[model samples]
Structures are given as C-alpha cells and as structure tokens.
Target: MGIKIVPRHGKSLKDKLYLPAIAGGMKTTFTHFVKNLKDTSNLKTMSYPEVQPEDLSERYRGVHRLTKWDDGSEKCVACYMCATACPANCIFIDAEERFDGVAEKRPKQFKIDLLECVYCGYCVEACPCDAIRMDTGIFSFTGSSREEFVVDKEYLMSNERSKDLNDG
Candidate 1:
C-alpha cells in the first residue's frame, strides 16, 4: 500500500509568530477572571465541608464493599474470580468450605491493600455472584499506618457506606 500524506494549510506571518494563539489564551483567561470577580455566586468554587455538591452521578465508582444476601449471609462464594481479574493483584482471599451448606465455599480471609489497588473496578465487574461492588460513594480516607489501609472482610462489610450500597 502507498503512504498517503496530508498537506499542511497555509499560515500567515502573524500565525507563525504564535502571538495570536497567546492573545487568544490570555483573552479567555481574562474573560473568566473578570466574570468570576464580578459575580462570586457564578464561580464554581465550593466551601468543601460546609457546602458539598449533591449532584454526584449514580455510576460514580468509589470504594469497594462486600454484598450480603437477603438472609443476612454474605453473597460471595469465594470463587477467586475477583482476585484473578485484578490487574494490580491487590486482593487476597483465603477460601474455606462452609459447613452450614448455605454456601459451598466462603472466604475465611479477604483483604485488599488500598495502597496497591488502582481502583479500576475490575474486581466488581469480575464477580460472578454480584458479591462485590464499588458503590460506597466514599473516595477519601486516612490511616495511621500502612496496615490500616489494608481493608479486611469485617471492615469491608461494616463500613459506614456499605449499608447504603444496595439501597439504590
């Protein structure tokens, strides 16, 4: 196949100097600055703690949480599908056979290292049983130590936002 080359458009002396481009950018900046200065209410700035915007989209993926069934039992079957699909390999799971027969297998231990997790939502998408989801709507957290960021099964289950995951 022959290579096809596109021709460049003609440019005047002023365009070559880049003065018009710079003036255009400065004009846009000055327009916005003057508009914001004239009307404080028109600015998009937020007071953060006091004035939080409630317009978050429903599809916003925030934090990961484990789902529960109707009978109060965990929905996960410990299939390792999430762990296997994680690109960052941040998820860890230890499966054990359930004696109660409610579930064929259950996670004896489940942990996720937040520091290593990329928050790609692959784990939630790979879960076959809808056992895991990233709908907590929580994006910020603090920890005293590295180990504290590693969330365990109990922490994931009882997190403040976990209860609201199924509401919508």
Candidate 2:
C-alpha cells in the first residue's frame, strides 16, 4: 500500500470537534457580554448595601440564638444536648449552676463558631428547654479574624434583644 497526498482545503476531524466547542464557549461569553453591555437590563448584580435581603420573622430559622427568659435571665440550662446534636461541633458550652436555684445550670461560656456551623438546625431541635434556637434572624455575619467569628453568648443574647426590640 502507498500513502496518498491530499489537498489541505479544509479542517481536520479533530478541528471539527474542537472548533464547535470553542465557538459554543465564545457564543456563551459573547451572549453574556452583550447582555451586560445593555444598561437597560444591567444583568450584573444588585446594588448591594443599598439592596440587602429582608429580615426573617420570629418563626423563621436563621443563625443560632440563645434566648433569655422574661425576667432578663438566660434560659439555657446547658445540658449539652445542643452541643451533642451539632453536626459541625460549632456549639461550645460550659455549664454552671445558677444562684436562682430554679434554673439548675446556665452556660458559663457558650460560643458558636459560625465558620464551622453547617446551619443544619440540629442544635435548635435538640434543645429540650427551648434555650437554643435559630429564630433570631440576624443571619448576616462576616469576620476578618477567628476571634471575631467565635460569637460568644453575649453577642447572641444581645442579638436576640435587638430583634425583639425591632419586632416590638
């Protein structure tokens, strides 16, 4: 058998497969580019800061919250149920008996690392006394440091009060 010389008039089979793919990718990019070029549509993004998401209601589930009682006292007994149920191990609690005597235990140092929290709501479900919950609705959180991300009980408790004030 002898090799035959053919004229280079067209693209090869490899080019046929890859050219269409390149064309499709370019078409997609161009389509988006054109859409963005039209200021009437503004197909980029929201104005941000000026256009933030709305607040969640009392019933709405958001970031984890530790609620205090009507008498301006912490409701958490810190039974470790919430910590045990937390899939991400975000909830950290140190229980100590209260002087009030009625409430056996309160969280001495309750901290939840939002970075590690999966927001699965298991901690909320595991609370027997309804102390820990995801109802505060202050979901927007960002931190530059690990210390900032580790939200202690004070911040969470104050957040609940702020929400209460807003709702009222």
**Against the unseen true structure, what C-alpha lDDT does each candidate score?**
0.85, 0.80
- Identify the runs in model 1 with alpha carbons over 4 angstroms from their true place: 1-53, 160-168
Where is model 1 poorest over a 10-residue stretch in terms of lDDT? 158-167
Residue 150 in model 1: lDDT: 95
lDDT of the structure predicted as candidate 2: 0.80
Which runs of model 2 end up more than 4 angstroms from their true locations? 1-23, 42-44, 54-60, 161-168
Cα RMSD (angstroms) for every candidate in the order listed: 4.6, 7.9
* Tens-digit per-residue lDDT, 56-85, candidate 2: 455655677678888878888889999999
Query: Taking the tens digit of each residue's C-alpha lDDT, what string does model 1 give over 1-168?
Result: 799999775377887888988999999999999988898986677787566457776777777889887777788899999999999999999998988777899999999999898989999989989998887877665689999989999988865453445577
Report clash pairs, candidate 2: none
Error of 1 at 67 (Å): 0.9
